[model samples]
Every structure is written in C-alpha cells, then in structure tokens.
Target chain A: MLDGFAGGFIEILQIATLMTMFVGVIAGIVASAIPGFTITMAIVLTLPLTFYMPPIQGIATMLGVYVGGLTGGMISAALLGIPGTPSAVATTFDAYPMARKGDPGRALGIGIFASFFGTLVSIIVLVLAAPPLAIVAIQLGPWEYFSLIVFAMTVIASLVGRSLVRGLIAGLIGIFLATIGPDPMMNSPRFTFDLAMLSSGLPFLAVLIGVYAVSQLLGEVEQMRSGSSKGEALIEERIVFRPLSYLMDTIRRPINLIRSSLVGVFIGAVPGAGGSIANLLAYDQARRASKDPDSFGTGVPEGVVASESGNSSTAGGGLIPMIALGIPGSAVDAVLMASLMVHGIAVGPRLMVDNPEIVYSIFVGLFIGALMMLLIALSSMRYFLMVTRIPKHIIVPIVLVFCAVGVFALNNRVTDIYLLFFVGALGYVMKKMDYPLAPLVLGVILGPIAETNLRRALSTSEDLTLFITRPVSAVLLGLAVISLVVFLRHRMRPRASADS
Target chain B: MSDPRSNNASGRPDRPEDDAAPQPEGISGDSGLLQFAFNLVMLAGFGYLFWEAMALPESRWEPLGAGTFPRVLLGALMLLNVIMLIQSAPQARAELGHGPRQLFGVAWRTMLEFRTVFTVLGAFGVFLILIRPLGFVIAAFLFAFGVQLLLGPRTWRNLVISAIIAAVATVGLQVFFAEALNVFLPRGPFS
Candidate 1:
C-alpha cells in the first residue's frame, strides 16, 4: 500500500494530469456556481472530454470536477440566496440570510473552510473503512435496499412544508412519474401510454433543471415584481474572506463539524441518500444540538458549516462503496463508475488487489483536488461574489437561456426541452400550492431502485418476512419507522400548542 | 434554485375543520377551497390511472406482475389524496358560500393574479415550439431577448444587454459543445 501510494503520487505529479485536474476543477466551480447547473450535469458534460485521457488521469480530473462542483454550489447559495446545486439547499437557509444581512464573505468563508475539512475527514474515513464497508454494503439484499429508501423517504416529512400529506403526494407523484417507462424487472411496457417519448421515461436531468432551476428563476421574477427596489440588488458589502477565522471557529465547534461530516459520509455510503439528504439531515442534527437552535435559519454560521461540510464530504463517501462493492451511491458516482468501466478497469472487491497503484493514486488525487478547490475558490471568490452586483433582470434572462441550453444538451432530445417546460410548469404550480419539490425529486431519483428491489425481493421468495428477518433490513426499517414517528410527534406538538 | 428554506423549516400550519374552527393558516379562504377541489380532481385522475393499471399485461413467469408495483403506488396515492380531501374539506365548503355560480369567477380572479407567471410561461412555451424549427440558438436568443424586454421597465439599455447576452451565450454554448466536446447542437435553415 505504501509503495502504491508513493507510486500514485509520482503518477499524479505529472504536469499534464495536474493541469487537466486544475482546469476540470475550475470548470466545475464555474458550472456549479450557475443556478440549475448541477454537479451531476457538469460531470456528465465533462465525461466525454475525458474519454481520451489515460484511466487514472481521466478519473483524477473528473474527481477534481466532482469536489470542486460540490464546493462551488456554496458560492451561489451564499451570494445570490439561490442554491447552485441541490446539495447546497441547506446552505441557503443560513448563507443567504448572512449575505443579505451584509456579510457574504463570512458566509462563503465558513462554507469553503468547512467544505475543505469535510472532504479531508471523509477521505480519512474512506481510506480506513472502505474495504470493510464495501464488504457490508455488498451484503445488502434487495430487502435492505428497499428499506433504505423507505428510511430516506421519511426525510421528506421534515423537508415538506408544514404538510406531510402534501409532501407524500409530491413524492408519490414522483414515484409514479418514474414508473412511466418499461417495468424494471420485466421489459413489458407498463405506462408508456403509447407515446414514443414516454417509452424511455422522463430524463432525470430535465426534471431536476425544470423543477429546481426553472421554478427558481420564475420565483426571482416574482420577487422582482413584488419588491419595490430593483436597485437594492443582492448584496453591497465589501467582501472580506477570513478563512483562518472561520477555520478556527469551525475547529472550536469540533462536535458539529465532526457530526455533520460523519452524517455526510455515512449517508453518502448509503446508496441513494447522496448529498441532497446529507446536507439537510446534517443541518437538522446541528439545529437539534445547538443551544441557540432558533438562530439557525436566521444567519447562524453553524448552519452553513454543517451544510457545506456535510455536502462536500459526500464526494469521498460516495466513492467508498463504488470502489469497494461496484455499487454506485448516486448518479454522479454512477457516471464515475462508467468512466472507469470505459477504461476497462473493473471495479469491485478485487479492484485494490488488481490495481493497488490506481486506488492509491485516487486517494492522493482526492486530497489534491480538495486542496486545489480551496485555493481556487478563495482566489476567485471575490470575482464569484461580483455576480451579486449584476441586476436581477439581466441575470434572470441569461440564466433562463442557460437553462434552455443545458436542457437541450442533455440527451440531445428536443423532447427534453418540452419536458423542461412541462415539469417547470408543474413545479411552479406545486410551488404556488405550498408543495415541496425536494420530496418529488428524491422520489423520482430513488423510486426505480426501490421498485426494482421490492420486486426482486418478492420474486426471490414470496415471504415478505425476509425484510424483517434480515438483521440489517430490519434495523433500517425500524429506523425508518422511528424517523416517521419522531417527525409526526414533533409536528403535532406545535399544532397542539396552537390549538390550546 | 427553489428557495424552500421557509417551507422546509416545517412550521406548523393551522388546520381547518368542517365545524366552527376559526380560519386556519395561509390556506383558509377561497384559495384553500380551490386546493380541495384540486385534490378531488387529482383523486379522480389517480383513480383512473389505477383502473388503467389493472389492464396492463402481467407476465406469467414472475410471481409479482409488472402492474403490482404501480397499483400499490396508485393505491397509496389515492389514499393520500383522500386524506388531503378530508383536511381541506372546509375550503370546499367555503367555495359554495358565494353560490356555485361564482366558482368560475373566483378561479379566473386567481389566475389573473398570476399574470406574470403565465406571461413568462407563455414565452417559455413559445421557445419550446420554436426550438425544433428555428434551432436552439435562435430560439434561445429570441426567448432571452423577449423575456428581458418585457420583464421590468423596458429600457433600450436592457434590450442591448439582453441581445448581446443572448447572442453571445447561444453561440458560446453551441461552439463549445460542437468543437470541444464533439456534441453537435442542431443548426437551423440559416446555418
């Protein structure tokens, strides 16, 4: 391992690989800073460019993009009060408030340092626990997978606005939408409704861009029309990035940082729970632990620290299962896996034995990528902060245009463009109706996996007891039940108080 | 992008009962009633989809047929809708307050309030329709330029900036995808 680690460092130290990694990281930051352009989307676009590079080099460069994109999301979330990526959703809760309150720099500073430390912690965990975790991950049956999704779905109750029923409705609608194409277990066309477009199911990218990005831009316009001052813009403070101070503060509150990072890593290791859930769950944990819990959503630095660290760490956490068990934890990880497969590098339990140098190099590359992201984000942050200075009207139209371009670029299908508008309209109505979009998006992403596993489990044995009989599956289901109960009880307490 | 922080805070919204419960939450009046009606329509749609799922061909080999999962989902969806219907029944009652004759008028007023949303959606719809025939670049430029021109006070300055941004953005994305990434974007008749 030591020899491979040394050799991998030598391998990555090559100038060409380093330069590409730098460029890829920069591009990721730029793309993810744009609202509606997700880290997954940026990685998808970057995949083709890496087709020509050698295996390790290509993977390293993409890794740069992945880590950079994760951090880049905080830029927009803090500055413009808009989450650049779904993972940064919680960052907006505090970062936006801080920025609007005239300290965008501090928000970004806290987020950046937190992201850096989070990545480091996840890397340490990844290096130490990946082999054993993969062994355990590979042991998960279809029952466990389904139960895992069930647990993940309970997070929707916390996320959905004031109404758990409305959230469930949104999530159910998402699951139904995902079921539109051929059945997962059987190739029989189930709900295509005889339309050619429905044959392949709705593209995930289009739905994400439509639901999150398009609806957001619309909200921006609505705000413009409602607010009296278009002149106020986003923020006007002379930005001051105090990285050392934020780092010190974060280190002082080691529990929040460690707990949030652990939440991210553990969630990331779980297939289907990626950064989206990680950030929120981490924030919720932080809120629950804080002495000043009420101060969270109102510009608390702890909230930003919890969210950014939680999300950034997921990159390494996601790689753990992928490198060890050959299962992808998220769509971006699936793409990363695909990139490796294209190079004929088989990923599984034997990956380390077969390519120790590659594994070691990837580990080293992660640290390098994280360090590079920190440097680039700090230097260019002033420039990124300048985006807030642009007037809303100008930003609005240009962003919408970018949305159109991005939608069309995915799948090269004009049908996707139509779907973007359709989903966008649905998102708008849902927004107006006080329904949460996150539940819907999560349901869409994880529904198929849940369905496939459920069917597989049922087919394997008609006995549904397999879910409960299995220790891990039972634990997960128990956890899901506990989560639902806690959420319900928590919600009822406030209502009962109001009623009395 | 969706600023869901306020929504996700999970604040306790007031719930209206069928009887003499004082107005509950942001959704107490006519809008709440409209939501109940919307749920009813959704219930009907889900019911229809459930019925349709019954007709899908089930493979003889698999123990669980393909339709089973969807049927399960539809059942859950239908149940959820019923709960929503129960919760918002008061709103539906309020809708009948001004007589059933004025329902259309109330809905029209609500729709009119979202004029900006509709107008923006209209421009997006036009862009979708135009993209295939006019190609991505032209459709994008037109949409950006048009939306920018209409959004706030339509200064010529806004027009110029929008125009430049639209053109530059459209061309840059097109060139980048085609030349650098080898992903060719569609070109219209002019190109």
Candidate 2:
C-alpha cells in the first residue's frame, strides 16, 4: 500500500512537488486578488493546455489553481473591501470594515487563521463522511438519482429572488442546452443541428465561463463606466502575524466556527448550491450570533472570520458527494471530477475498494493544502495587499485576455474560441436584460443528469407514475414541487404588492 | 473603486433596500432604451431557439422530442418578455421625448466612472492572446506588468518589481505543473 502511494506519485515528491506548490500558492494569490477572476474559471481555462502534460501534473496544476483561487480572495476582501468572488462576499462585510478602521492587518490575520480552522474541520468531516456517503450512494437507482437531481434543482429556493420567472426561464434555457449532444440510451443525437462540435453538446466549461465570467465582466464594464474615484490608499496601518492569542479567541468563539463550518459542509453536500450560499448563510449566522450584531456590516473581524472560514471549508464539503456519489457539488468539484475521470479514477463505491492510494493521497493532500494556505497567506499578505493599488482599467483587459486564452487553450480547436465569443455575447446580452446567471449555470450542470436519469428510470418501470411509487423518489419529487411552488409564491407576492 | 470603505460606515442603516433592489427608477433615459434593446434581443433569441426546436425530427416519444425542452424554454421566455413589456410600457413616452441628453448621461457616467475596470478587462484580454504564442512564462510576466502599468504604477521600480514577481510566479507554476504534477507547459516560441 505504501509502495502504491510512493510509486504512483514518485514524480510529485521530488523537487517538482515543491515547484507545483509554489506555482499553486502564487496562482492562488493572483487569481484570488483579481476580482471576478474565479479559481474555477482559471482552472477551466488552463485545463485544455494540460492535455499535453502527463495526467498527474496536469491535475496538480489545476488543483494548485483551485487552492490558490480559494485563498487569494481573502486578500482583496480584507484589504480592499471587494469580494473577488461570490464566496468572498461575506468576507467583505467584516474584513473591509476592519481594514478601513485601521486594523487591516488584524482583519487579514484573523481571516487567514479562521480560514485554516474551518478548513481543518471540513477535512475531518470529509474523511468521516465520504465512505458512508459512498455506501448510501449504492442504493441510488436511476429513479433515486433522478429524484436527487430534482432535489438539487429545488435549490432554486436560494436563487429565486424577486424575479423568479426570469430565473426559471434562464434555468429552462440551460436544460434545453443539456438536451443537446447524443442520447445515452438509444445512441441518438438530440440537438446537434448537423454541427459536429454541437454533437458533444455545449462544453460545460464554456457555459460556465460565459455565465460566470463573461456576464460578470460585462456587468463590471457597465459599473466601471459609471464614474468613480480611482484613489488609492492603504487602510491597514500594520500587517503582522501574532497567531496564538487569536487562535485562543477563535476557540472562545467555537460556536461561530462550528455553525459556519456545518453550514458550509451541508451546503457543500447539496449538489449545485456551492460555496456562495454557504458563505452568505455563515455571514448571516455570524451576525445573528454576534454580541454586537450591528458591528457585522461595519467590518467586525468576527464577520471576516466566519465568512472566510465558511466558504473555504466548503472545498472539503463539496468533495464529499463527488467522491461518494459521482455527483459534483460545485464548479471546482465538477472540474476535479472531470480530472479524476481523465486520469481514469473511477468515482463511487467501487473506487473505495479499488483505489485506496488515490483516496488516501486526496485525504493527505487536503490536510497539506490547508497548511500550505496558512503559511502562504501569511508570507504573501503584503504582496497581495499591494494589488489594491493596481488600477481597474489594466486589470479588466488582462482578465479578458486570460479568459480568451484559457477558453481556447482547452481543446485547441479554433471553434472553441468562436464558442467563447458567442457565449460572451450571449452573456453580455443576458446581463443587460437583468437575467440571473447562476441558475443558468446550475441548470446546465444539473440538466443532463436530471434528464437522462429521468428517462432511464421511466424506461425501466414502463409506468409514468413510477416516480411517485418509490418512496424516496416520491419524497424527492414532492420536495421539488413544494419548493418550486414556494418560489413562485414568493415571486407572485412581490409583484402583486408592487402592482397594488 | 468608489472606495466602498467611505460609503457611510457610521453604523448607518443600509442605503434603503430599494437602492440595492432591482426596482426601476423614473421611467426615463438610458434605462428605457436598454430595456427595449434587451427585450428585442431576448425575444429574437428565444424565437430562434423555439423555431429550431420545432423543425427537429420527431421521435416515437412525442412529448420528449428533441425540441421539447427548447420549445418549453422559448414559451417561458416569450411569457417573460410579455411581462417585462408590460412593466416597461410606461417608458414609451420617455423614448419619444428624451433626446441625446438622457442617453449621453448614462454613457458619460459609465465612461468616467468605470475607467479602471475597463482598462483591467481590456488588458487581461490582450494578455490571453499573447500568452500561448509567447510562452506561459513571458506572457504571464508581461500580463501582470501590463496590468500594473495600466493601473498607473508608472515608476521603473514598480514596473521592474512587478515584472520580477510575475516572472517568478509564471516559472513557479510551470515548474509545479511540469515536474510535480507532470503537466507540460506550452513551449511556445521559446523552445
């Protein structure tokens, strides 16, 4: 067993491992620092380039990008008051305020520390939860799996803002796109439009980039054009590391860590919802629990602590379902799932029995990754903070270029570039029209699973009512109906009130 | 970059939910035009998707035809557009009365306000194009330096420092991917 671990990853343990770590740490910092340039987007864009590399290194590089992107967001949120990604939004409520109050150093310090703690807790949860979850997954027939997808889609509870109709429309659009490519059952093509590339359907990464990155970029462009000062100053008077006392204080607020970590883990376990909502829920909980609730939006270090910890911890939480059920729980996890498949690493229960080394390596990597983040965050704090001084004008173009390169680098087909721009235009138009992008993304990710599984489940039963006959499927379908109704009700109430 | 730090942080109540909420304010000016343009585009996209779906070959499973999902999507979209049109019906008058003032107001405001944001996005796009052909190391290094420059960090010291940082970062990533994870870096023209 030791030999398996040793032999398979022999190339990694040498100097190359150190180099990869360095790259990951640096990439993490940069991607995190840049607003709207998410780790998932970065990894997706870079993955195609990795096609030329050996499997292990390619996976490691992407993994490095993942870790880097996750950790890097704390830098901007704490120092500059901007959350680089949705996950970091909670971090901004406290970190930015703390930075402004002249303790940017303290805010950043506590954030990194809390992040480490939350991550540690999550890793433990993953180790305990993965195998059991995998076992339970064995019971999931196509009917059960379809029901689970229905349950996942029900997460529209969180996404359904005042504009539920618009959100649903976007989601339906995503499902339609999922109907593209070939049918798994009858070897029939669904919506190929006679185009060969479309036969494979829309690349998940392209859709992801379009909805998440391009739409965001366009929105940013609009926001930038609205006249604002480009003034620069360091709100933080000092930046240093004094860890022990802070650790003790965090321990004192054990409930904060635990509550937020649990929120992260649960949300992570739920497919499609991802860390964005977890971080938000954690931030809300932190505020509700604070001795001074008003202090939250104004920049309490506790707010920063809860949020950074909550969101970062979801990395571990998200891996649970993917490893156990072969169902990706977030975009990054989805990419990781793809990587595992690329490396011929089977997911689900069989993987547990067959590949203990890979599993153990992952467990070890999670532990080591968290430690690396702490050390890297501390040493790189000053450098990351300096990013705030870089003007917006320069940053946007660079990001756009990276997106272009990243998109094209994947699959070396020039057609992907055309797809990127087409999707970009679609994204720009969508943003202009005020349609939410998240549902579209979640739908695209979850659609195929829902559709194919539903068809298969129905096929087996020869009964349309079979969905309700099975207890688990019936319950899941019930929940999905109830959630959709609830969301629609929420939407209707607002419009009725507004009109009245 | 409005230094979100300065936004009335005296433990003040949030700037009213309405400000943050998506409610349309005073049905005049750019908002109206934007609404119209977007409405038309969405209408067309949805229409095309629906049309294409309907044209697809039918299967034995009638309800679950290839075009079923797309048709359903377009139907929903068309309904949404109708609702949006109703909401925006009041703005029709503003369209007829308002001249260049309203349009320019939104344009000029965006231009002056988000200059930094524009530069950043633009430069990033350029960096991506240059990267594959130029090699990851050089492209990344140049990209970071370019961003710093566009952000107005003009001194040679700042430029050189950022360049070194970018170079180190690119090399570090390359080494990690190539040696440790076994990812091969694009040799580009350098090799």
Candidate 3:
C-alpha cells in the first residue's frame, strides 16, 4: 500500500497534480456559481475528454472536480437567491435570507465550513464501507442483481414529492425513452428512428445537458427579459475559519450531521436517487428535527449545515455501489463508471481482487481529495460569495455560452446543441410551473436500467407472473405499491393551516 | 369561447363588495397567456418527436420493436401535455393578476445590456472550426477573447482575465486529454 501510494504520488507529481487540482476547482466554481448548470453536466461534458488521457491523471482530475463542484453550489445559493445546483436548493432558502439580512459573510462562512466537515465524514465512510460491501456483492447472482435494480426503482416514489402519480408517470416516461436504443442483452435494436445514432439509443449525457443545463439557460433568459432586480449585490464581511472550534460546535449537533450524512449516503447508495434527493431529504429531516422549525425557512445556520453536509456526503456514498456492484449510484458516478471502462478497468467484485493496489490508491486519492476540498472550500468561501455580486444578466450569458461549448464538446454533434435548446425549453416551462425537475432528471438517468432489466427478466422467463413470483422482485414491487399509496394519501391531505 | 360550464379556474369573483371585490383585472394575471404558449410549444416539439418515432423501422417482435420505446414515450408525453394544459387553464386565469407584471415590463433591461449567450456560442463555434486550422493554443486564445466580449466586462482588465480563463480551460483540457490521456482532439493548422 505504501509503495503504491509512493508510485501514484510520483506519477501524480509528473502529471501536474497541482495544475489539475487548480483547473478542477476553477471549473467547479464556475459551474456551481452558475444556475441551470450542474456538476453532473460539467462532469458529463468533460468525461469524453478523459477518454483521451492517462488513467490515473484523468481519474484524479475527475475526483478533484467532484469535490470542488459539491462545495461550489453554495456560492450562488449564499450570494444570490438562486441555487447553482439542486443540492444547494435548501442552502438558498436560508443562506440567501441570511445574506439579505447583511450577514453574507457569516452565512457563506458557515456553509463552506459545514461542507468541508461533512465531506470529511463521508470520505471516512467511503474508505470503510466500500471494501466490505464489495465482498458482500460478490455473493450476488443475476436474480439478486435484478432485484437490486428493482429496489432502487422502488425508491422513486420517495423522491416524487407531493405527487407520486406524477413521479411514476415521469419514471414510466423515462423508461419508455430509455428503450430508444438497441437492447443491451440480445444486441437487437429497440426504437432506432432509422437514424444511425438512434440505434445507440438517446445519449444520456446529451439528455442530461439538454434537460438540465439548456432548460436552465432558457429560464434565466426569460426571467431576465422580465426585468427582475436582485437588489444590491451582497457585500462580504470578514469571516474567521476556526476549524477546531467549528468541529467542536458541530459535534454538539452530531445528530443533524450524522442524520443528514446517513440520509445522503443511503440515497447515494441507491442508483439514480443522486444528490438532489439526498439534499432534499436531508433538509426535510433537518427541518423536522429543529425545535424552532419556523426558523428553518428563515436565516438559520442549520439549513446550510444540513444541505452542505448531506450533498457532500453523497459524493462518497455514490461511488460505493459503482465500485462494489458495477452499478452507478448517480450520474457523476455513471461518468466515473464509463471512464473506468474506457481505460480498460473492469469494475465489480473482480476489480478489488485483481487490483487491490489500485483500489487502495483510489481510496487514498479520494481521502486526500476530500481533505483538499475542505481546505480549498474553507479558504475560498469569501471569494465564491463575491462571485454572486456579478449581475444576473452578465452571469446568465456566460453560463449559457459555457453550456453550449460544454454540450458541443461531448460529441461535437449539432444534434446535441439542438437537444440542449429543446431541453432548456422543457426545463424552463417545468420551473415556471411548480413541477419538480429532480425526478425527471432522475428518471432519465434510471430509465435505461429499469427497462433493460425488465426486458432481460421477461425475455429470460417469458412469463408475466415472473415479477410477482420471485421473492426479491415481489418485495420490491410491494414496496413500490405501498409507497405509491402513502404518497397519494399525503398529497391528498388538506393543506396544513399554518403553512397555508 | 365563454362556455358557462367551463368552470374556469381563472374566474375572478364578480361581487362588488369593497373589501372582497375581485380586482378589476381578471384573475390569474397573464399566466393564461404563458401557459397557453408553453402548451403550444410542448405540443409542437412532442408532436415532431412522435412523428419521427412513428417513421422508424419496426421489428418482428411486438413490444421490442425499433419504434416501441419512442412511440410509448410520445404517447405518454402527449397524455401528460393534455393533463397539464387542462390543469393550467383554470389556474392560469385565476392567478393572472398575481403574476410577475414588472418582470415582463421595462424592468427586463439587463437582458439587453450584454448579448453574452450569442457571442459565447459564436466564439465556441469558431473554436471548434478553427481547432484543426488554428492549433489548440491559438483557437483557445480566440475562444477566450470571444467569451470575454460576450461577457461584456466593463474594463479591459476584466476582459483580459476572462480571456485567460478561456485559454486556461482550453489548454488544461488539451493537456489532460490529448497529452496525458492520449485522446484525440482536432490538430488543425497550429498542431
């Protein structure tokens, strides 16, 4: 292990490790500082480029980006009312309020500080949890793998929010869309539109960029046209980072951090649940736990803490399933999985057995990356906050331009550019209406998995009752049904008098 | 157009009671217009999608055919659109007056100040085109400058900085992917 680190570090130094870290942090900050664009989109667009690089360097760059991106989202949320990423959505509710109250410094400080701490906790879990889980995963057969996918799919209802029916509809819609490409198992074409590229199915990255990034750009443009004023740009005050003191203080509220991190890890452990739901669930749990719940939506530090903690932890937890079971736990992790394959690194149980040295290297890399993220995030919180002071009109165009380039960079195809615009429009409308965008994104990411497996299962059994007859499938199906019922009942309930 | 049984969700109270009297403006500000516009656009987009899917080649299998997934998605999208339109019509009219009046008015001044989106896209387009001809460094420099122009920095200092950002991003990507990972980026004139 020591020798491996020594070799990896030597290679890392030769590859301009500091430069990679710097570039990653900058790109992450820019991506996270802008609304409509996300770490997932940034990572997705960049993944193609990794196909061109050496394995270790490419992997390290991605890891750096992941850490930086997670913390960067808080910049916009703290400075402006807008959240740079969905995970930061909870952050904005309080951070923006606190900023408005003229404590932008403290708000930004607390968030960055909390994010650094939370990420550290998650990294520890990743280091410990992954190896054992990989061992357990080795015992699984095709039936178990199929059941695991079903279990992940059943979690969709929990993410659906006020409308499980709508969420299911969205999920089904996503599954249907996933069928556009050739079948994974039989190599038979499914829904190719006679166009050659369609045979490969819809490019998940293109869809992600289109649905999330482009949609956001269009929405901002529309909103900009309406002449909204964001008030005076927030002025920053001095914020001291007392890490020891901060740690002690946060440890006193260990439940909040532990609870949020666990929720994040769990959500992240499930393929497709991703960061958005993790942060949302964390925020919800935090609010529920707060003695003065009313203060949550106001300028409370706990909201910032919970969101940053939750979202950052997801980065660590997301890699667990991917490394252990060869299943991507989130979109970014999906990129990681793809990158590994491109580099001829076989994932799953065999990866650990064959490349224990590399596995240990990755663990070390991730741990160091987490610490670096915390250090960089803490020191630079003030700078990120300053980014929010830029005018919305200015920020929007810059972000949009980046989005276009990023999208085009993926496949260098004009079709993807158009896709970006189309998805941008869809996102704009969805935002304008109050429909949640996370589930749709989640649906797109998870759709193919569900469809491929469902078809594979059916083809193997050729029996309609196979889903119910299998014990694991039956359990997952039951969970989905019960979740649907619970979600509907919750939505149907009369509005709470106080909130109304 | 004004069917009495429409049960318009946009219906404002007609009562003249001074306190509870509906505002003179109709209910649901201009959301009705917005919603209608949104629905029309979605319809057009999804309609094309459905048509395209229908045009695809079919397989011998019933559900596993080439057009199976797109057709299913198209149908679901159309259904969802219908429900959304139906749901929005009433709510749009009801909330018409409550919508962002100023957002649409002259206050939308900032959008005109800097045409960042177009310039950035144009610059990026040029970058891709010139990558083979200009080499990574040259193309990257132009891309940076173009993005800076789009950003509309008030001073040359900021413009220079923005340009540097573009250059760095380009160079970094080139170095990592091409030099390190050995992935091919276009090596035009300057390469």
DockQ of each: 0.42, 0.17, 0.10
Q: What's the lDDT for all of these models? A: 0.79, 0.62, 0.60
When sorted by DockQ, best at the front, the candidate numbers are 1, 2, 3
Encode model 3's per-residue lDDT on B1-191: one tens digit a residue. Answer: 00011111123321111113223232221244454456657667777878877766654443454555567767777777676566556644554555567435422433343244434444545654665567655666665556445434357776766666656766676675555434444555656
In candidate 1, stretches whose alpha carbon ends up further than 4 angstroms from where it belongs are: A1-4, A34-56, A76-86, A89-103, A226-241, A270-273, A280-303, A325-351, A496-500, B1-14, B17-30, B99-109
Q: Candidate 2 on A1-500: residue-level lDDT in tens?
A: 56645644564454665566567657766766655456776677667755665555665556666666776777766765555665775576667667667666677778878878887888788888865653454556788778877776765434433345556666777766676777655556766778866776777656655554554544444544434532233442444545665566566778898888877776676665556667766775675456665455566667777887788788778878877777877888888777778767787656657776666556555556667777887787766655544545444434444455445545544455446656665655554455555566557767877766766675566577777887878887897787667545654674599889
- Sorted by lDDT (best first), the order is 1, 2, 3
Q: What is the C-alpha lDDT profile of model 3 across A136-253, one tens digit per residue?
A: 4344434445665565455454444343334544555556656666766556665555666566666655565555555444444433433343222334344343555555545566
**Cα lDDT tens digits for candidate 1, B44-134:** 9999999989987786666778898889999999999899888877666765675655766656665665677678888888988887789
Could you tell me the interface RMSD of model 3?
Answer: 10.2
Off by over 4 Å in 2: A1-115, A126-131, A173-200, A210-365, A462-464, A478-500, B1-30, B58-63, B97-191
Which RMSD does model 3 reach against the true structure?
8.5
Over A134-235, each residue of candidate 1 has an lDDT whose tens digit, in order, gives 667667889999998887777666556546677788888888888888888777887778887678788776776687667776777766665364534556
Considering only chain B, report the TM-score of each candidate against the true chain B: 0.82, 0.71, 0.59
lDDT score of residue B148 within candidate 3: 48
User: Where does candidate 3 chain A have its weakest 10-residue lDDT segment?
Assistant: A225-234
Per-residue lDDT tens digits for candidate 2, residues B1-191, read 11111122111211122222222322211254566556667778778777876876655753354555556767887888766666555554355356667656755765655565556555555655665588666776676667655553457876676666566666776675566434455567884
Which one wins by DockQ: 1 or 2? 1
